[model samples]
Target: MATPILAQPDVDSGLRPVPVTNRNGVLEILRMRRDPFSFADEKRLRFGEVSGMNALGIRMVTCSGPEAANEILMNKDRAFANAPAWSYFIGPFFNRGVMLLDFDEHRHHRHILQQAFTPKVLKGYMDEMQPMIAERMTRFPTGKVLMLSEFKQLTLDVALEVFLGLELPKPEADRLNKAFIETVRAGVAFVRKPVPGGRWWKGVRSRKILEDFFYEHIPAKRAEQTPDLFSVLCHAESDDGDRFTDEDVVNHMIFVLMAAHDTSTITMSQMAYHMAKHPEWQQRAREESLALGEHLTYDDLASMEAIDLIMKESLRMCPPVPAQPRMAIKDTQVQGFFIPKGTMVVVPQMANHRRRDIFSHPDMFDPERFSADRAEDKAHRMAWMPFGGGVHKCIGLYFGQMEIKTIMHHLLRGYEWSVPADYVMPMDYSALPVPKDKLPVTMRRR
Candidate 1:
């Protein structure tokens, strides 16, 4: 037997009830974690567009397909809130970050935060990080290496120096990186309590580490002007002269660091795997990078169209933060399916990116599809939303893109690598998509 997700609906609204599975969604949580795309597709086929399930003791409406995604993300009616839903998973760890705010408050904070990401600010960041990136790239070993871990370390290095304006010793950097990893992994941990040595406990303890670091440094950042993110956030203000308090700066700093580092790592790892598998594309992108000279300038970042295409295609295939979560704040309807207030909603961008009706050869790794001649992603407005959509779309998109392009630019100029043609890198869908076997590559200097 199935229960209506809406339980009951207003007759005049003329909306149908969302179909929810009778089985416990909490039980399906593990199965879905194993492969969320397959699970999403299965439910969509069986129950139609708006499928409902209870996961981790919360009832959620999965807004699969383009229409549902459009309605939810566009949020025309302002019926959704990001805080309650995200907080359910990452609340304590990332509390009150920009993504966690709503409506007026969200808009205000975004306005102030926008100051840190302007064209001039981004140029400063690009200039600052290029040398940091180049210095790290110069140290790559000349044999088989775990590309994912390597990228993770590089991105962490970039974030700590470029974001915090601090160059800590190896141990401190490693400690900060470990704290970030624990806090992120804790969000999805099955055990929520602070049991001894448990994920939640580790995350709670790590949160203190992060808070202490940022809180300790906020005073110095506020006292001076620097090009790093910490200084920018400390000084950035809206037209109304409103700026972030020390607490606000610390919260935003922690959240932004995770977002920037994790997403860049995932994107780089996916691109590396793709490049290793398809050396022809690698060769092509390499040529483009070589043409631009050894060190990339702010303007040269856009010239590497080959790298840009590959990045877009890689992001499409293995989107970081694949599913965007929100909760209905008021009675809302998505594509004629009624959603009761308080029901959690998920926009499955990774699954949506592969829709047959939208993307041709959705599973194929063809970068040309994004080229001007093809423009397959243009089929629908929400067709290629790896960064999400509407007002809550990622704020750091420009900075993140520049960082990836800069790193890839350096990588192509200095080295080349490959993986066996027969190999298929397995992905762990449990958390953010990471290669189960840290992708191994045979590398040598160009």
Candidate 2:
């Protein structure tokens, strides 16, 4: 038998770059800030499949569709790195967060972090989460309400209680929430500096406050064994006896807390948008929640299939992290496109989610597509990567899901809500995707 020769990549040539007339990404940023979906769709059409653009002083090769996203996210060849690329946007603010680590360091950190999210620990979190969600649901005012703002506060409170073991006073919690908001907003700032009253300035100050807060609490957490995540981080060790330093604990805590609450808030708001828009799904989910009980057990969460499918649909429509950024550590090929070393690459999940080839009626709000009968998500492994994929996939995904479902479960049982028939949610993607107007709904007791 004769051995076949492998074709060599044309490293001398570069990607088919997208023509960008906007210097410094001013026009691109305006388009993305205006309507990210439209901007992505336009890119897909203009660039065909693989293309490059220079934005914010970064030269990025944007890979569209599931195949390219799978190639970049799965990291099969090890040619891409996450940290260096993410640092361009968020490194200064969320420096050394696990998502900003790559290769062995990422694996090491993730191993130590996994101890905090074990099955038993997650159950305890759910146990605490149930009552908090129920209590929060009970307080939602009847009639018109902004569900996004309400959900944001509710999720932040849950995160503080379950993750940090803190029952902050209303004023303190609000202050911390604002701090997180500023820190997150900093990732999208064009100036990337601490000019007075600017996003970067606010974020720098917020990072200091969060650092002080976590550092102050580290000593207390280390002195005792508590079920909270902060306590777990203070004590968690890898199988090899690797553990976090004081700075490591503080850095990880700040990142995890922001990830937990902010992403969960966005997901819940999307869930509310879908539930309120489609009353049939709402009724089905409400029945499931009511039948189970007022408080959800860990097992109950698994069996809530209707809510699960709705959650999947919501994520498919509006993934919290819409785009994944990575840098080419070495020369590579993505779908026959030559990617040179040091080029920033974006795998746009929001664009991939709308690919007509993968999803039937891609823009429609059809939860049944995720049902076992349809199993549309099975079309491609990368088709619905809201939580991302491979080694760097989100560790807290299950907890986030539990938190969102727990809140939705309580909301469904306690209230019936609806948006106007003609309503369309105006999504703002300044940082994470959120309803711009906070998702107004006509909420009332059941």
The digit string of per-residue lDDT tens for model 1 on 139-167 reads 98779899889999999999988899998
Per-candidate alpha-carbon RMSD to the true structure:
1.2, 4.7
Deviating ranges (above 4 Å) for candidate 2: 1-24
Q: Relative to the true structure, how large is the alpha-carbon lDDT of every model?
A: 0.89, 0.86
lDDT of 1 at 362: 86
Candidate 1, superposed: residue stretches over 4 Å from native: 1-6
| lDDT score of residue 256 within candidate 2 | 94
- lDDT of candidate 2 over 1-446, digit per residue (tens): 32211123454665432333333466777787688778888766765777666677777777888888889989999999999998888887788999999999999999999988889999999888788778877888899989988888888889899999989899889989999999999989989989999999999999998999898888999999988999999999888888899999988998999999899989888888988888999999999998998867998888999999999999999899989999999978788777778888888887788888999999999999999999999999999999998898999999999888888888899899998899999978878898889999998998
Give residue 392's lDDT in candidate 1 (0 to 100): 91
